[model samples]
Target: MIVFLAALLMILGLIGRMVYLMVFDAEYYQKKAEDLHERERKIKAARGEIVDTNGTVLATNRTVCTISVIHSQIKEPEVVIKKLSKCLGMEEAEVRKRVEKVSSMERIKTNVDKETGDKIREMELAGVKVDEDFKRYYPYNELASKVIGFTGGDNQGIIGLEVRYEDYLKGSNGRILTTTDARGIELEGVAEDRVEPVAGKTLQISMDYNIQMYAQQMAEKVMEEKQADKVAILLMNPQNGEILAMVNVPEFDLNEPFTLNQDQEISEKSKEALNQMWRNGCINDTYEPGSTFKIITASACLEERVVSLSDTFSCPGYRIVEDRKIRCHKVGGHGAETFVQGIQNSCNPVFIDIGLRLGTGRFCDYFEQFGLLGKTGVDLPGEAATIMHKEENIGQVELATMSFGQSFQVTPIQMAATVSALINGGKRVTPHFGVRILDKDKETVRELKYDDGKHIVSEETSRTMQALLESVVSEGSGKNAKIEGYHIGGKTATSQTLPRSANKYISSFIGFAPAGNPQILGMCVIYNPQGVYYGGTIAAPVIRDIFDNIFPYLGIEKDVEMQYTN
Candidate 1:
């Protein structure tokens, strides 16, 4: 009787458990069964567009396709290989290798043209799969390649602004889920489930397309004419610090960033060469500013009252500073001249004397004050910091060289930003490119903000410096930069590279327009030009030619009263 009772209890417990599973756990088990037959594939989201301030598209995406193969679904291996190889223009052997691989899915090729992908899709060969994807396209090919950067096979940012703002530039990927049978074939009469991908936000930058084109044209012309190693041009608004254009000559094609732009054997092209080609010399590299640095020295001196514009000094070609004899550019010198003439002549002796008057303590103080000694905090990547002698290590000789823009190194962007400060009402602005971010509907998602700038010098000193730089273009070394009816102001630099004996020089010029109330500021740097490598001669003229075209296009009217004088 006891055995029979135990058997009955066991049967009753089994019945209760079956009822619970059928009723309470039915949904969960059903989902698990459905999941076993479901196959999921990913859909790539389209990357955002990059536009200029004028709404001109600089970097955009083109529809492409990714060709993949499902190993289990491929029944006719030889037929699949033949069709895929012919359609994809790939080797049959290669297609066969991937088709025979024991994997869920294998990618044959990505970035295939849409037309070709559509052709493959129409074949409806069981194993072959084509999905829409995006490939970054630069309409201008090589324009601003380094700054806009490029993406990798995974569609992730590689460098430049693309990588810098990756979060905003990349989008969320979606999925395509389909029901499949045991044979890995799509189940009949079943509809596929697709989750649409979300596209990235549009990035708007301060770069002006027209200005950039003109600047690039001028840079190419100068580089070809001078046979220089390279040339870089940067343009910005001194008042607001918006970089209008940045040109690095011999720019690599954004589409073919891996290929070297120079004439060299494929095997000889090293990674370093590619890096150098992509490098934006204007911010990534540093050099002695030479006479252009004189702008900083003069501004500091004037602010400190160490020297007045009318203060007179004698320059018999050189100055003796702590046993070191520093020679001026003009060996015969200007004999006796006021401080204004000294600046125009770029006299080393006059600046050295004034630097001595300011003293080492004051000179270092100004160096720190001028925003030199640090990065410009530009939006671009790989910005180099100014290389300087430590304040405590600076001596009479170091101070003298620093005064005339030597014995230290600063990136071109730093020089441009600091000079902008000296001329733009004493506020040191951060040089940047990003302007705003927008959604697909063109609504403002976020307006980018940068440092509003710190007050470095007084407004009075800024005005005085502006006038002094205007004299540099009007009557001094930078005369070649003068436009016929524009009140242009600038400083010229001819700095020698290291080892002194190498004799290689970088010719550069930093200039602004309508000097009284500065607007556009630009700098042209020509590295290692052949003969006639003076900044005033080669570099200054490049800016003049660019401004001549860009100024008119930008609707900057000429100053009717400002006349050119020989």
Candidate 2:
């Protein structure tokens, strides 16, 4: 009777303890139970796409699967390895190593196609799973390869616009709260609590698909014909600073960005080739503007009112400054000519005289005003340029060479943007590619913007410069650049390269069309071109061809009917 009574009292005390626990620790115990059964897994957000102004997709996504294995749940490791190796085209050992990893999930491969993923899923091999993911694709292949750079393995933009607009392209990742049993088996009939990932914003760029193709085609043809190391071409609107097309050749396939396009055995040479392949010279690299820079000096002279149309200067083929004699293109000299005629003749000595007149202080001021002293505020990566001479220390020789566009380095885009200013009523406009950002629903999130630009010269000066440039195409060094029916004004430049003995050169051309009210501005730079190295002979024709193709597409009517002869 005493033992029964003690048992009953003990039972009552345990019940009292349970009641106290339910009342005091209920919330904490419930949370612990929930945590034991639930697991959270990441859901990768879909990367945004890139499209041209016409809504033709340039960069898009491919639906792919990420194949992974849970080591704890994989019962027959050998079977899983054998099947995965065959389906994924990987080594059996590689599959085995991945399956044996000490982790919740080991990714065997990513970017597996749906058909291949379906084949793996049909096997239903224990612990093997296929999850949804995305792979970036450039449908246009090599078109605008540098401008629309390819992404990395993790879908991050590594170059060009891909890197420039990363924040908008990379969206927030979501998660799935899965309910699983103690043995790592997902519970039956229990719906997964999901937080859906938001898709990234889209990048609407200024590149037109047809225009990009035209520019690239011209670049490729010239790159092969010229047998040049590389070629870069850029076309932009002088008014708004929108880049219509930018091409760098030879272009590599964006799909296989790491693979070398050239036929080369794997070595240090191959490594260098790869680095050179990915480089975007239009923005990241710098080259001496050569004769293309002459326009800057002329524009500066005109803007500063140091030279007039009627002002006459004599060129004895060369000018003497501080023991140095800078020679003109014409060895015999263009002696006794008006300032306008000097520009038409592209007389180096005449420019040297003009440069000496401006002095270093005044010339550098015009240079800074023209956007050469700093970056153009372009929305790209790795912009570069060099101001060889400082204003404070400028001497006779330095000013002389600079006057004729020598001894300094600037990128092609910088020269293009500055040229636009010279023609576009002297407005110092900033060059740019992006147009606007759009949400998943195609709603306008915001406008991709740039500065409104400042006036660097009077309208009258701009008009006068346009006429002089037009004369260059009509009767000067740039005559070959003329599109018979349209008035195309441009300057030709041939610059000497390093190690003066090597005789390498960069041949370039900068031009605009419809001389009266110029619309499109362009510049082409050809590096180490074989055989002929004159800009008028080599680079000007390339721009002329590009203009021939793009002129009609842009609906810019030929002001005068000077039918082009094929």
Candidate 3:
């Protein structure tokens, strides 16, 4: 009886200790469970707005409804899945699979709109919940789609202006982490959170919507008329380097990008097409500048004092340099011509002689000075620098060819900006599309100006180049670009396709409007036309067309007093 009592006493003592731990240490176990159920929820801040120069909204985001599912609360998984599949237009099998995979019972459909949210909620379906999210919307549709770009499903900019200005467009994401109950409901207690999100800033572009639309229409019309492989158009303020309009033919709609692409396997051809579509061709593509480059050669020669304006060269069809014959565009020859006449006729042999005078050392010096050896560093993506060949092979013949824009490749924007500098008093300005960046309160944080200038050449050289260019339209090869009331100056280019493969050509026209006191500088390019690929034939007329509508529409003074200071 004494031994039995001792064993009973020991058992009672052990039971008492067990009871103490269960009640006194309960809070410790509860805290660990809470930690396991805690979650950090991301509160996404809204994306910034993209507006035109005139303050028209190009892209914006708005709050919309979303549907979610919680497996633990679901009374009938199969029935709920079936109803959700029908209402959300999702496959029943897919919904069932998603519901089954919910480790803690939270899945979201990501669809927006009150009608859809209401339809799902009307079912009184267990486990279903409604939430709000911001969705991107583009108002312009296909207009300036490539320029404005688009956002992806994750609300991130993937290309064009979207990707270029992502830092300013994507706002910071705020987050919160809190413990939840067994039912996945937040407990009324302190929570862990992060800093509040900073809303994205607004971007006010330099684009003129009306001009953009017209330019796009003109590109489309030309693409159809010329049956061109590709067409690119750019309009800008020559005096300021501000881009007023930019358009590329075969434009893809940002809201519907899938139509242009089918399978995602990227090939060389597909890559080229994608680049052609996604990139702004004015700054992205490089081509032999053709005769348009003649002006640069003339400028180099004039600036280096190697050739006088009245100097003359006789051409009996071609010039022989190191046993290589350089032929003129006229084939048989331009015969005899002065420096001005040489530029007027775009005489290849005359430019060759001028290039020889400038010499390899001097020519390369001016080439780099003109900003042709590197990228323009414009505020766009994929800006290709001029393709300068090996300087070792830059002999008299090569220099001659380069003088006329044949030996080196250049982008259209490079040509435009350089030409603009040539005419705008030697002020080498950086070209830009975005005019300024504004905050939510419409406060300007950044604004672009043209006075950030570097003098490329003397004022005399600029004036001389301007006069020479004007003469081309008035009495030379670019007569087709002449407007009755406007003093228009332009350069025509017919660059030969590489490999001399079957004689293909890429024609281009670049010029500025109201030649005196210029306003708009424009460039148009047509790649591989079936027939008549001369820049004057295919490209100049396009410039004329653009200027014709643009002048009157822009309300620019056409009958302004002609200042004959030059």
Candidate 4:
């Protein structure tokens, strides 16, 4: 009787436990069971398209295929390996290794062409699964390659605008769920469940396709003709900070960013070469602005009332400060010239005098106030800051050299932005490319916002500087940049590179059109040209050529009457 009762109690306990599992833990166990039979495959989402202001697609996507394999489902292993190896252009050994692996799902290859992928699909090879994917494609290939950037194998942005705005450019991956048997074989007559991916938002930038193309052609033409180490051109609207075109010559192919353009084998050093090749010199690299920086100095002096356009000055071609005698570009010296003439001649002595008169304290004040001491806060990444001497470290010699756009370094974009502020009604504008974001339906999602410009100079000072710079292009050293019927204001710079003994030099020119009310501001920087390293002779003409072509294309009408005189 006791044994029977004990057995009955044990049976009841077992029954109670069974009841608890069925009622209380049913959902947990049900999910576990579902997971065991469900085979999950990821579906890659399409990246957003990058278009210019005119809706010209600069970066888009091309449909490709990702070929994966389920170990248990694959029959005729040798046949599968052979066909995949040939179709995917991979080694048979590599294909076999992945196919033979005992994994539930393994990616055999990705980015297979649509034609080949369709062919494999028609073969109806068991265990082989082909899913469509998107690959970033640059329609113009090398055009604006550095600015547009490229993606990695994972479809993530690696550099340029691609990386800078990754969150807006990358999409959410989806999943494909299939019911399978214990052996990982898909069960027949069961429809696969799919979670569709959401594509990234479209990016519309301020870059104009035509302007970028024209500028790139001009940059390439000049680089090849001059045999320059590199050439960079930046064009923007001074009134607003919208970048129209930015060209860094030797631009890599956006489709083949990792491969070098040169005919050389890949090596460990190739990584460094690739980094160098990917560099956008206009913003990434910094150099002495030479006379282009004089624009800043003149603006500062004029703003502080330290110098006037009519201020009399004498340049014997060189100025002696403290223990240093810095020679001017014109060794004979510009003698008995007004401040306006000194700027036109780009006489180092005249600027040195004004710099000293402004005093180191005021000079540093203007430097910091002009936004030179910090980044320009551009939307792009890796923008370099100005390299200037510490305030306390700036002695008379330092101050003198800094006066004529020497002894300090700044990026091409920095100078362009600052000069824009100086000439464009004293409002300091932020240079930018990205303008708006759009959804897949082309509906406006968000318009990019920028910091409001701060007043850096008085309007009177800005107007005076504008008229003075116009004279420079019309009658001064920047005469090469002068165009017919246009009031072009500009400055020329020929700065020697570091280790002055090496004799390497950078020639640069910064200019703007319709000087009375400037619209476009452009700068050309040519590094270490083979010969004729004068900014006025080489750099100035490049801008002229680009403007000449772009002006009409942009529908900017030329003034019927001449605005400035020689």
Residue runs of model 2 more than 4 Å from their true location after superposition: 1-38, 181-183, 260-273, 561-566
True-structure RMSD for candidate 3: 5.8
What root-mean-square deviation over C-alphas does model 2 reach?
5.9
The lDDT ranking, best first, is: 4, 1, 2, 3
The predicted structure with the larger TM-score, 1 or 2, is 1
True-vs-predicted CA distance for residue 255, candidate 4, Å: 0.8
How accurate locally, in lDDT, is each candidate?
A: 0.89, 0.86, 0.80, 0.91
Tens digit of per-residue lDDT, candidate 1, span 1-566? 99999999999999999988899999998887777788899998889999999999998999999999988788788888998899889898888888899876799988899999999899888888999999998899889887888888788888888998889989899999999876667787999999999999999999999899888988999899999999999999998899999999989899888864333555544877778888988889999999998999999999999899889999899888889999999988779999999888888899999999999998888889888978899998889998988888999999998889999999999999999999888999999999999999878899999997688998888888888889989999999999998899999989899989999999999999878878899999999999999999999998999888888777888886543211
Per-model root-mean-square deviation over C-alphas: 4.7, 5.9, 5.8, 3.7
lDDT tens digits by residue: candidate 3, 139-201: 878888777888876788877788888998898877666666766655666565565667788
Better of 3 and 4 by lDDT: 4
Query: Best candidate per lDDT, number?
Result: 4
For candidate 1, the 10 contiguous residues with the lowest summed lDDT are 260-269
* Candidate 1 local lDDT, residue 499: 86
Give the CA lDDT, 0 to 100, for residue 426 in model 2: 82
